[model samples]
Target chain A: MIMKQFRFEPLAQASYLIGCPRAKEAVIIDPIDDLGAETYVLEAADLGLTITGVFETHVHADYISCARELAEMNDVPHYLHESATDLVQYSFTPFKDGQVFEVGGVRIKTLHTPGHTPEHTSFLVTDTARTDEPWCVLTGDALFVGDVGRPDLLLGDQALDVMDEATRAETLYRSVKDRLFALPDHVEVYPCHYGGSTCGGVNMSGKAASTIAFEKRFNLAMRKDTPEAFAAFVKETAKPFPDDYARIKSYNLGLISKDAITEAAV
Target chain B: MKPTEVQDAVAKGAVVLDMRPPKPFAKEHVPGAVNFQFNRADLAERAEMSLPQDLTYIVHAEPDPIAKVAIGILSKAGFSVDGYLEGGLKQWKADGLPTEALPLLTVDELKDGLDRYHVVDTRESFEFRFGHVPGSTCLEWTEPWDQMEGLESEKPLALVCGDQVRSAYVASVMQRAKMDAALVFGGMVDWLERGYPVEKSPKKAKAPRI
Candidate 1:
């Protein structure tokens, strides 16, 4: 199995393609816009592989996701957390937490890691050819290289009350230490976002991957600070709410037709 | 000399010294005016380097009060400061001097025009990525100005970002360098809001990569 990560620098977002060369099967995670899908499909075709599944970690607010569009185009099943059905309008096979799915020899175990949003999930993928411990954990917006997703984006009816700086900070704290840190230290941590991402306040280095142990030691957002201090710190550093967030969210919920993708070389 | 005499000297190619911060100068000003930040301690050093003592000097500020103080400084520097721009830049702009737009570009514009123009993105890289005009080389505002010295001495340049202030500063810098440049009015937000085309980064480009 070969895994490649695509970093979308503008949005500070990352997507993944886990391919099993022997079986010619693959899966994509958290597709951001159409670029990820186009790149992954071209690369997979170049390597003689086929995409069987598309997984969306959650409805992202920062950028529009083309996961449903990509899945439909490729004739692949789209996977989402069962709880996400209410939040997302697209059709998908709802996988409950702890459910395991197989793509060739790779076994993926889904873990509910909701704080970034109520339906967020992380996938731990184990290669049968390798050890029982997963090779890498695909943590979407739920965890970043040096920070956790800010929970304030999903505050709908209680948008004002739940988004009080302190409440979101405490929620982020619980999501990281309680859910993500419990994984084995040796497991490679592949986060969905890096620095420059407005989704999380403190993304770390530009490098796409880090070890759970490495982040546990060097990630400032992971340090043992009091909840009060953490709240204050995040409040001070938090980005102003993105101007296009509501539009992006509505797009993610299938409330609007996907905009035509423009083709211009970067 | 009187203000009318100063205006007459300016018509004959005398220098109009705009002692305002870069921000106000970029918005609108006397067409050929030069700016020197009044608050900087190295004001003398910068003025000496950029300003030619041979030309008659006319001091100006956004409001008139600062112009009076600038005239005093120029006199102390041995400049035969003639007079000031009465009512300063505001008056000049109000009188219908040319004003430029500052805009962030769509990715498509960046791709099509990147080679033809000097592409300067003033926004931070993170902001650049959420979708920037393609082909734009990011020159972060915090980065040292000398790094951009390699750009040709003469080219039509465009400065882009999420807003006007930063790009306007960039345009002023290029203008000071005597380069042909303009601010992409309204910045990137304006471009997108108007439904202009923007290319996604190549790695993230799901659409056919042009």
Candidate 2:
């Protein structure tokens, strides 16, 4: 199995390309607009792998996703959480929780870890050539380096009907503590954002990667003994939404054209 | 058994048991290989139905660990599993042994060629009852040869399940018996995802918990 992390320092966003060398097939996760489709395709070709599938953790409120562009270019399937059926205008293969997609000896299993955004998902990846046990989890924005994703992204946004801040925080807490934390301690953690990214709380570590055990022991968000306390902690660490948060989200949902967002920025 | 030894075993009338799912087996496999997918639950039952005890067997599965587990399962199930092929199918291919393939029909193809095939849903009875391909006949994986024998032999049997794994296993078994069979890639899940119509059982029945 071969894994590559493409980190966009400008947005503090990280995307991954994982593939099975023997099968010569790869899947891109949470591709960002900055890097574009060609970057993934060219890199995969250089590595002797064909881009077989594209996956999105969720509709990003922070930035535009290149999932559609990449998937279309390769004529591969774009996989997203099934809950996004009504929200997303683009074509995708809606994946349910526990759905497994295999690329040669590497198997990717989906875990619906909502709360960061209602349709948020984390991918549990196993390299069957090495072992059946998952070697690492692509946590998306649910579980970060030292903190959790800001559940308050949708707090005051009225463009879409979404969960309130309090409910989202509580749900995010359960998603982290109950679901993500249940992974074996040794499993490596790779998240979409780190410190300096508004998507995560203030305490998020700048370190790109950590382990499940390390985060469980030291993450401030997980230290809370109860969900109520966890919610309170999450709410307190909320950051101000970016000026174009709604538009960026809308762009991701295909609600508005990319040209509209770019023109608005100019 | 090593790839070099596969021919010797075959010459002596030993069957090559391919433990991988039907998809890979259908794509390419040691000619005359029988597929009985390796899994913990019901391995013994499925083996009993799919395999003949009279012949000695050579187990073949990819990734050495799974092949090891398959050998253990076959041994415990009271079958004569001589040994597993070292380095699995990769090594077998590297050794340049001849292989064969079965048809792997996509949902789109199945949709277009519905009239030409006999669709068989290999999912559980309750799952089949809940929703299934309009004309598919439900025959769960564990169903015996007598049940499969009732299938329309005139038309090519197209096997399908939730995902294609179970269907692929069933396809391999049918192919071993010289039946004209094809594995429905992406299975019923793909069919439903494509918004294809399905026929549900008139009476709603609860699926039994495993």
Candidate 3:
């Protein structure tokens, strides 16, 4: 089994590849655009693995997602939460909460974790050969090592008023406490963002991974103890949204397409 | 790339991007130079979106590697980069050309001059609140476009920011608008870096989402 994390430091974004060498299969989580799927495909082949699927935790608002492009190139399923929309001209394997995907002896379970965006999901990985107990959870935007995802950005231009800020903040509160932290405190935590990311202010630690126990004890949002407190904390600590956030979100949802990438190639 | 060639390019209105931190840029920059300031949050996206593709741009950034990065990004985003400025603004100064800057005055110089000139800080509220040159007013960077009516008529004005580089950017607007504003070199950063006194205020200026 292999879990590799790649960081785009320019934007402070984190992406991952989890693979099973025995099964020669892999999955990518929360991939950003500009980083071509070919790069990952070639890397996987060198490691004796093939990309089996690509999953997104949510429709991101910061940068375009290359999930669709990557999945197309790999001839693998591109998965998103069932509630996510704007599929454009492509198809996806829409998933529901608690759905399980298996590759060899590793079981990947999806947990619908909404807050940053309504369709956000987290994936919990269990090595069934070792134990039914899970080993790690990829908490996308739902949780970071020292901070929870900021929720207010879901409204306004990005979603075109799909939902209000306060409402999503409350959802983020529930998503963190109920869905993500529900796993045992010792579960290894991996997120799609870390320090220097504009997602939050001050509290986000640059550490690669954290135990649920460590986050529970020290993560500012987790320590808030109530939904109201969590909501307030999130609102208070939200950094200015990332640059080109609305446009990037639109591109990710296919409201806009990568004419820029094509233009660059030309 | 020679000083005279740069002057000729400037005469032809070649876009000059001074990619230094705002304070250093403020401390010294070419008159009419555009300070992209490289450190401004979301700089890459903003430059990609706003820079004109048809016009040729010359870049001058510290740490030569960053200048290369700027040229790469600008050219990739369809900007027609003329070339990197040879030796940056330092060469311009050594060549005895007029490098525009707000008079780098001590506190006493600012006190004597603040009332004689329009003084403004170009940083957002959060940064301004941390500390600023005393007696300077907070003006959002886009105030020229949004709040021009409230601004005083173009006069001998002084522009300040956390770094001198930002003031140079604002100075570009003043140059285009025919407003007489000068860059306050060694802005708040230099003020603090030099252990000069700054007025403290208990407020948090949230950075605006650009």
Candidate 2 C-alpha lDDT tens digits along A158-237: 54547877778888889998888999999999999987888987898889899999999999988999878988887788
In model 3, the runs with Cα more than 4 Å from the true position are A86-90, A155-161, A260-266, B1-210
Instruction: List lDDT for all candidates, in order.
Output: 0.67, 0.82, 0.72
Candidate 1 residues A123-197, lDDT tens each?
998988677777888988776777667767753545322344456567667777777788889888888888788
For each candidate in turn, the TM-score is 0.52, 0.57, 0.54
DockQ of each: 0.01, 0.01, 0.01
Q: Give candidate 1 misplaced runs (Cα > 4 Å).
A: A34-36, A155-168, A226-228, A259-266, B1-210
Model 3's chain B TM-score? 0.62
The superposed Cα distance between candidate 1 and the true structure at residue B76, in angstroms, equals 73
* Highest-DockQ candidate: 2
| Model 3 global lDDT (CA atoms, 0 to 1) | 0.72
Instruction: State the lDDT of candidate 3 residue by residue for B1-210, as single tens digits.
Output: 766787888799887787664445556677767667553235567676445456678887743445666678777767788877776666778898888653444334555566676667778778888787665667756454324224564447677776554565666666655666666655675567667667756764322222
Worst 10 residues of 1 chain B by lDDT: B201-210
Q: On a 0 to 100 scale, what is the lDDT of residue A84 in model 2?
A: 88
Docking class of 1: incorrect
Query: RMSD for each model, in Å, please?
Result: 21.6, 17.4, 20.9
Give the clash count for model 2.
Answer: 1
